[model samples]
Structures are given as C-alpha cells and as structure tokens.
Target chain A: MREPTVRTQKIKKDTTRTRLIFFGILALILIICSVFCEYLTPYDPYLQDLKNAKAPPSLSHLFGTDRYGRDMLSRVIVGSKASIFSTLLLVGLVTVLGTMAGVFGGWHGKRIDTVLMRISDMFLAFPGLVFAMAVAGVLGGGLQNAIIALMAISWPKYARIARSETLVQKEAPYLKAARLSGSGTLKIVFKHILPNIIGPILVTSMLDIGTMMMELAGLSFLGLGAKPPTAEWGSRMSDARSLLSSAPWVTLSPGVAIFISVMIFNLLGDTIRDYADPKSRGR
Target chain B: MDQPALKVSHLTKVFTRKGQPDFTAVDHVSFSIQAGECAGLIGESGSGKTTVVNMITRLLDPTGGSIVLNGEDITRMRGKELRKVYARMQMVFQTPAESFDPRCTLGDGIGESLRNNGRSRRETRDEVARLMEVCGLSADFASRYPHQVSGGECQRAAIARALAIKPRLLICDEATSSLDVTIQKEIIALLNKLRREKDSDLSILFICHDIALVQQFCNRVLVLYKGKIVEQGEVDAVIRNPQDPYTRRLIDSIL
Candidate 1:
C-alpha cells in the first residue's frame, strides 16, 4: 500500500472542521439571500430609472445600475433565490426518483435491469441541453416547467451510476451474507445495499447540484425558465444582453453570481467526493 | 440419529462468463455430514470450495444438485422456502471487514441477523451480549463499529452473528484467512468451543486453503483441485497417509 501523503493529511484535517464550516456558511448565506430577498435589495430590480441608467458604481448602489437603471446588487441577490430554489428542487426530485429506479434495476437484474438501462441509454443519447430544451418546449416556459425538464434529462445519470454501484454492492460478501441470514429482499436492498452505496450516491448528488444549477441558468437565459421580473440569474442575463455594450454591470453582476454559485457547489461536491472515498479516509 | 445435518449430492456449479465458454466451478460435488460433525472443504483458490459452501447456504443456486438439510430438499427451494432454509444455515465470510455494514456498529451487524430471523430488539440485545461473550468479546466492544476494532474482533463478531440464530449448519468461507495466525488459532478454538457447548447437532463446513488448519479442526477433510474432489477421508487418515498426487502436492506445500 502507498504511504499517506501530506496532501491526504491536509484533506483529513480539512474534513474534520473546515468542510462543515464551509457548507454551513454557504447554506447560511443562500438561506439569508432567499428569505430576505426584498430587504436585501436597495431598489426594486424591475423598476427602471431612465435618467439613472448605466450609472457607474457608487456608495448608493454598490454595483451601480444597469441599462434600465435596475440595481445590479438587488437583481443579483433576488436572482440567486430562483436559481437556487429550482436547482435544489430538481436535485431533490432526481435523487428520489433515480435512487428508486436504480435500486429496483440493480436488485432485480435481467429483464428489469435490461429495460431500465435501455431507457437510461435513450435519455443519454440526447445531448442534455437539447433534451432539456425539448422537454421545456413541450411543457412551455416557467420555473416549475424548467425544473421538470431538467429532472427528466438529469435523472438518467443518477440511475446509471446508482445501478452500477448497486450491482457491485449486491455482489459483495456482506450482501450475500445478509441474504443467507434470511433478510428479505426489501430489507437486503434497503439495509445492506442502499447503505453501502450511499456514499457514492451522496457525492454524485452534490456534484449534480452544480450541474443542475447551471442547466437551470441556461434554460432561464434561453427564455425557457422563469419569466421576466422573476429575478433569476439567467433571465437577468437575458434582460441585460441588449445593453451589453452600454450598461455592462447588469450582465456582469448576475454573470458573476452564476459563476460563484456554480464554483461553490462544485468545490463542495469535490470535497464530499474526496471525503466519502475509503482510500482517502484511510489517509 | 436425527436426519443428517446436511446432504449435498451431485452439487455442480458452472460459470459461463459473457462471451466465454461455459466452465464448471464445482463438478458433481457430493458430501454428507452427520449431526454435530465438522467437515472441512480444503482447496486452493478457484477450486470451487467457496462455491460449494455458497450453494449449500443457498447464496448461489446450484446448476445441478440436491442439498437436503435436516431432511428438507433445499436445492429446489426458492424465495420463502430458501429463506426458511437459510434460517437454519448461516455463513461467516472471508474479509470480516467486508462482511459487515461499515455504516453500522458491530452490535448492530450481529443484531441484524437476529432481527432478520424475527428476534425483537429487546430480546436480541441480551442474546447478542451473551453471544459476544461466548465468542470471547467484551460486551462494551459491541458499541464499536467494525472499523474501530481489529480484524480478529470483526471475525469474532461475524462468528457471533452466525451463531445468533443458532444455525444448524455454519459455513466458514475462509473466515479466518484474513486474520493473523494467532487470531486464526483463537477463532478455531472458539469454533470448537461453540460446537461442543451447543451440542445441538451444529454441523460446520470449514473452508480454507491451509490443509494443516483443517486437520487440526475438522473431523472429515475433502481436498479439491480444479473444481473436483481429488481426495477426501477422515482428517488423520488423509493427513498421515495421502492418496492423490494433488493431495500430496497440497500437503507438501503446507508442510
């Protein structure tokens, strides 16, 4: 076996305290941004001031004003709520549906596995964005519809990963021992296989959160997500496109918000992935 | 005098990997154990020793065979019937670390077998403690998870879990191979103690690669080579006066 590296030691120490603090702070910020959206914004994001349009950054409006004189800071904060909420909802739906489908497909192999995997392959064949767009087009544009569209395209990834994990877990000696101990199918699947594979599932779900957020933003940018005045990052970017050359702050603020949010989620996901791995834990 | 503890006749297992030709893992293997007798299945890896044990425990359905345990034909059993058969037979797997749910503590893992067999939590807690003591583990260790304990302790916990339901047939599939030699001796001693104390026709199928270990523990020994039984007889007779070339080779390797 390879000796533990300094990097591994740092990760172990990092996981003990800093990781939890990071998540706590991120969650707290997002919650406060969501719950106090109105209070956090100095001006109504939709209210336009033609005279104040394209104003440079100042103490009154820290991020300055957009082409429509909408406060960039206000729009960014309010927009985060829509993106965060929709992504969280999409992830929740996918986790539940994907895990169930995976457990079933993995536990009952042969026909069930074959059919479920075929369906997953079909979904995988379509480019995720194209698939989401098609679904959104069919369902029509709205926050809820975009979430539903994202879920339809995203669940297959979880299903495939979950099924593979479950299949491997099912063959493990402990699972076989559980079966020989007279554990029923339900008990074996839920108690033995599910618990064993949960580490991977959790890590994947965390990573998927970032992907789902980006997808939601993309849909919003394409006008297939939340409608105007909804204060979503994608829609804000869409609204500011015409003023890209003039009032760049409108696009810059929400664009920066999207980037930071996605980066934070990705970082958190990577941390979780590293922590959940047994090899990494040993270090 | 009661029905033989286990009757395995013509047990054969074939594995046909995808895109590969069919191959026999256990070829027409047959054996019978009297009540309370310890039978050792000795073989090298890929010799199908574990497969036979798996088949007997109903973990793997045999391609061709009949396993009659306590006069019940478990070979044809399915679902509920198989589960009922399982209640009477338990297995201690190799790699005790992998034998447990890492998320659960040792007590939980042991208690799980009892729970599966319909033992209540209140009833099982005391029994679990008692079983842990019988397996030479302290009751306090029950609170620790598998990872928190040594490999030997984990194996003991596994043995205790196997014995939880008071199984008629206990299959140890290289159960002690992953442990140190001293720990292996201790585990072997524990098995012998449990066998004598239970005195309830508790048959054991001790599977391992070490012929010497089996000779010390089991009454009867079956030597397997390449999925076929090359030699088998009373432990002393086979160990002292070998029969097949393969058996002699194995003995030579061990000595």
Candidate 2:
C-alpha cells in the first residue's frame, strides 16, 4: 500500500464528519417528529374546536389555529411521520422493482427487452404526475392508493436508466470472458452486470425520493390523496388556503415543512453522488 | 498423419446491412490444423482474420460451413454444447486491459473459468496463484485489479485466464498487437513457451498483421486477402517462394 498523506487524510476526515453531522441532525428530527409528534400536539389533530377557529399564534395554539381550530404546528409535525416513512417505502420498493425489470430486459436484449421498454415508453408518453393522478382518481383517495398511482408511473424512469446502463455494461469485455468461463447469461447478469450499474441506480433513487414526496403532497393537497380530515401535510395546507390573510401560519408551516424536506432529500442525493465520483471527491 | 486439432470447412460470414448489399467478411475459407502444429493467419485490418477466429470460437455464427474440433462438429452448438466447446478451445484478445472485467481482482478474473467448472475456493486460489506465477506475474498481482497492472502484465493475466481451462486449441487474435515491440516479442516468447511446455499436440492459431513476428513464431502461415486465403504452406516455403500475387504484395509491404 502507498503511504497516505496526513493533509489529504485530514481533509477527507473533515468532509465525512460534516456529512455525518448533517445526516445525524436530519435523522434526529425525523425520529422526534415520528415518535413524539402526538405529545407535542397541544390539541387533538382530528378534533375541530370551531369556537377557537382562526385564532392567531399564542401559548394555547403554538402555530395558531387553522380554520377548524386545529394547531398548525401539531398538524405539520404529525404529518411528517406519514410523509417521511412512506417516501422511504416508495423509494425502496420502486428501486427494487424497477432495477429488476430493467436489468432483466437489458440483459435479455431481444423480445423481452423490446416488450419491457415499449411498456415503459407507453407509460412515459403520458405526463408522469397526470397519469398518477388519473390512477389515483380511479382508486379513490388514501395514502396507499396514491402510492400505487405514483409507483406505476415512477418505476419506468428507473427501468429506462437501468436498461441503458445495463446495455453499456453488457459490452464490457468481462462479459465475453464470463461466457468463455462456461458461466451462463443469468450468472453474468447478476454477478457481473448488476454491481457495475448500481452507482447510477442509487443516484437515480436518491433524486427520485424528493420528487415523489412532492407528488404525494400535491395529490393530498388537491384532496385526491389522504381523504377528508387526515392531517397529511398536503391536506393541512389545503385546509389552510382560505385563512392565508388571517393565519398565514396555517398553510405556511406545512408549506415550509414540505419545501425543507424536499430540499434535504435533493441535497442529500447530490452530496452522496459527488462523494461517489472520484474527480469530485479529490477536492 | 494425425487427426486435425481444428477443422473449418468452407466457413463464411455475410453481414446484412439494412437497405444495402450484404457484405461478406469471410467467404468460403477452409483450413485445418493438425495436432501439435502452430499456424499463423496473417492479413490486413479488414482481411477478416478476426471474423474467422470469432466463428471458430463460436463468438459469431458463420453464415455457412462447419467448425470441427477433434472430430466433434460444433458449428451450430448452443447453450450446453457451446460451453463444452469453450472447454476445448479458448481465445486471447488483442487488448488485455480491455479483456478483463475491471471490477474484479486479477485472481478472480483468472480463476473464473475454474469457478464455472465447479472448482472449490481452495483449489481456485491455488490454481490462480500457480497460473499467475507461470505467466511471470508475482503472487501480489493476483489480488490487484486490471488498472493497477501495466499493459504487458495485463496481457499475461489474460493469457493466464485463457490457459486456466487448458483448452486443446488456443486462438490468438492479434493478442500482442497493442503492446510495444519489446513487449510484443516477450509475449510471443511466452506463448511459444506455453505451447512447448504442453503436449506436442497443443496448437495455436496466431492471428496478426505482423508478418515478421508470424514468420518467426509460426511453423506454417496462411496469407488472407479480402476474406480469401491467397497462399498457405510451411512458413519458410511460402516466405522463400511466394506463389500468389497478393501474397507477394503482403510480403513486399512489410517494412
């Protein structure tokens, strides 16, 4: 092994430490919002205290009362549990499903490839969110149904990316060696092909997570997602629209939550991608 | 007097381009290498020598004719039968660095054939170590990746990979063409050593455009011109007394 320079090592260590602290803070926030959200909610999120409706921020109503007099801070905090975890689930499931289909089609590269790619193209030809909405509209409102709609359209993007990457990997000379090694195509695809393309797949997965969250929130905000009276971030913001002048806190709190969460996921993705790239890591 | 190690009977390859006339890369080329003979196939860039090797190794299917190894026809073998052919014949590519799957250690890359052949980990490790040593690579080179090695070393590793299967016929597709002249001479010597160390029955189909190297290394030579064999005989006989006009042209061009 070559001797490592102290200066370069220290720089690397500092960058790692910084990323660790950043993710640590985000993780801590997530845990607190998911676990202690109800305790933090001064008022029951579902209960409508019409008598105190449209009240301004005060000790009794920390983020001020919504039109239905629910605490705005409580609603946004409570909604975080649903949005955060479901986004994780959506990202995880879609990546597995998409990467599998894409790798399979790309490796096979004939009739199977043609059929799989054509199907993805058929779906992609329609605008992504519009198709998700159409599916959600048919399934009716709820987190699960909206998720299904989003997932149906979302997996194809990964499938296309993975498929193109697999095509490039297939041409690598190692594959010819693998064939001469007496290994079959399936073995070559799984053992050799999959690992090479994993980096880009992960980068794509990270980029998708934030956008998917926004799509989910947009669905709920339009009343096509979590249904009536569910304190989803989007649903809460929808209810707060009329009271913008009186209690801007009502919509603004959830809006800011949505924006921050999306930004965090995007930044997390960008930083991780840059870390994986050698040229970027040198700095 | 001995049975041919490899026989290609009127092999042909016609590439069909859309909306254009079909292109014939190698047309009606027939030759046979007797057991223990080293033959070189020499040609210019598009003379279709690589196409011939690809057809013989089953990398590309011939539009016509048969490829027989040790009297077993494998012209149209697929799946299991094709794999069996791989055990009988292996090819070393032109560029060694590009030959390996860069993701794996040299040990893993060289040991892959044995692994596919169902050799256990201990056996594979021993075999990889031994092959690396034979290829003139140190034991440490086994654990290193392709990028960490020099071009000559990479070619040696590639040769080791081809040798792991102990195939009867080794096909060299301009295997040393990418290296400098000194390394090329060294690689040619190593290949000669491999052939001599094995049974006298071991055969090599050395493919190159380098006529001088082919004249020195190969016992017999076939001069291909425009997908057709123009002249072939004992290397000394053909070089001293060329019959075909194209063969004369090829020899005259060497400088």
Assess each prediction's global lDDT (C-alpha) against the native.
0.86, 0.86
Worst 10 residues of 1 chain B by lDDT: B78-87
Counting clashing residue pairs in each candidate, in order, gives 1, 0
Q: Which candidate is the best by TM-score?
A: 2
Which docking category, incorrect, acceptable, medium or high, applies to candidate 1?
A: medium
- Candidate 1's displacement at residue B90, Å, is 1.1
Best by lDDT: 2
Query: Where does candidate 1 stray beyond 4 Å?
Result: A1-16, A36-75, A277-282, B230-232, B239-245, B248-255
Scored by DockQ, the top model is 1
The interface RMSD value for candidate 1 stands at: 1.3
TM-score of chain A of each: 0.88, 0.86
- Report each candidate's C-alpha RMSD, comma-separated, in the order given: 4.5, 5.2
